[model samples]
Target: MLWATVDVWPELEQAVLVEASASVRKIGQSLAVGAIAARADWVAGDATIDLDGLGPADLVSAAYVLDEIAPASLPKLVGGLWRLTADTLLVVEPGTPAGWQRILAVRSQLIEAGAHVSAPCPHEAPCPLVPPDWCHFSRRVARSRLHRLAKDADVPWEDEKFIYLAASRQPAPVRAARVIAPPKTGSGKAALKLCQPDGSAGERLLSKRDGEVFKSARRADWGDTLA
Candidate 1:
């Protein structure tokens, strides 16, 4: 519940706080939300800021921040974040090859610190993806008139691609393989690129001949889990 940021965006904080307050009021839990918000210490500092003063939280997140960090300082920063994470730590970055590489490096660092990979990967073993290939996902966002004007675009929506890692202090539960690409369906057959729990990744081809599995494959999307 503690929200901290390195940037000094008073307007951003106020807007989000107002929206959250409104949501709480609508749900008739304004008092409860108020108490939590009141207790939260909003600290604004750079990545190198001392975390010792921030205390521990159940969940810690570093979003769009790692890409700004120097390569040599990443380990130290990650170590500090992990230390403050009482349960889980989340890190997010842009969905580019370079961003994925940064996430991969952070994943290894967290694993070395005895953290478990809680998401995006079913296994804690080294990533199966090699150079020239990286793991990322996309979300479609509808653009507003102002947004369209700013970008000078005509498209109603755009894909916001990103990559993230979730690491937990406890071991992660067993999970099914993850789909890494958009499903390709044709001729009553479906092809999916999957990252399996066995620390391997490859394509899975299914046809109507496969029965129920084929039906499931047809409904699956990128980032979904498959058995």
Candidate 2:
């Protein structure tokens, strides 16, 4: 296993070393990259941490890091990352509209490079969503005492909106449509917003008369992949 970061932030560097210890302790191989290589001594005890010869990995992930990169450098950075991805590449960003646009751009670039969409999107066709609307999802996050104080929040939890893309070098297994929004239910009926396999996004209203399909709709949650 390997971990890389562009900067040498003390906390971040320490965190990476801590996380990589388990991999090093058990498997006996790990590589440190970029500026973190300068502090190579603090890595796992007795493990030989290589400071050179970086190579492609099976899975590559870039989370919330693109936002720190300059827009003009994005293409080059993404291309470099993709070249390093032996199988899959996962990218994540804040779920704001601007964040979604950045992901969308990356999505296009990956597709153009022959990668296949593996999640959140059922098809490779251009995102069905248009301006004034975009694809995103929310996750419930528990807040620490310090976090609560920082945000001045009354709730112990908050919804973190985020957008992500999982692209693979090979075609992905067939998947069902993804629920793009919270389902609306009332009086034995449900309306679900779906991004379907046919490369379309729309609402589908299901009622008791539809039996199992209706039941599925009622039970569906945002971000679910429904058949």
TM-score of 1: 0.80
Q: What would you estimate as the lDDT of candidate 1? A: 0.78
Report the C-alpha lDDT of model 2 over 26-75, residue by residue, as the tens digit. 44223444434334333342111231234665666777767866788788
Highest lDDT scorer: 1
lDDT of 1 by residue, 1-227 (tens): 22333233222322111121344445434443553433333344454556666667666788777777788888888888899888989899999999999999989999998999998999988899997988999989899999999999999799989999999999877778889989899989999999999999999999999998889899899988875
Candidate 2 lDDT score at position 48: 17
Q: Enumerate clash totals for all models, in the order shown.
A: 0, 0
Clash pairs for candidate 2: none
Each candidate: RMSD to true structure? 7.6, 8.9
Candidates' TM-scores?
Answer: 0.80, 0.76
Clashing pairs in 1: none
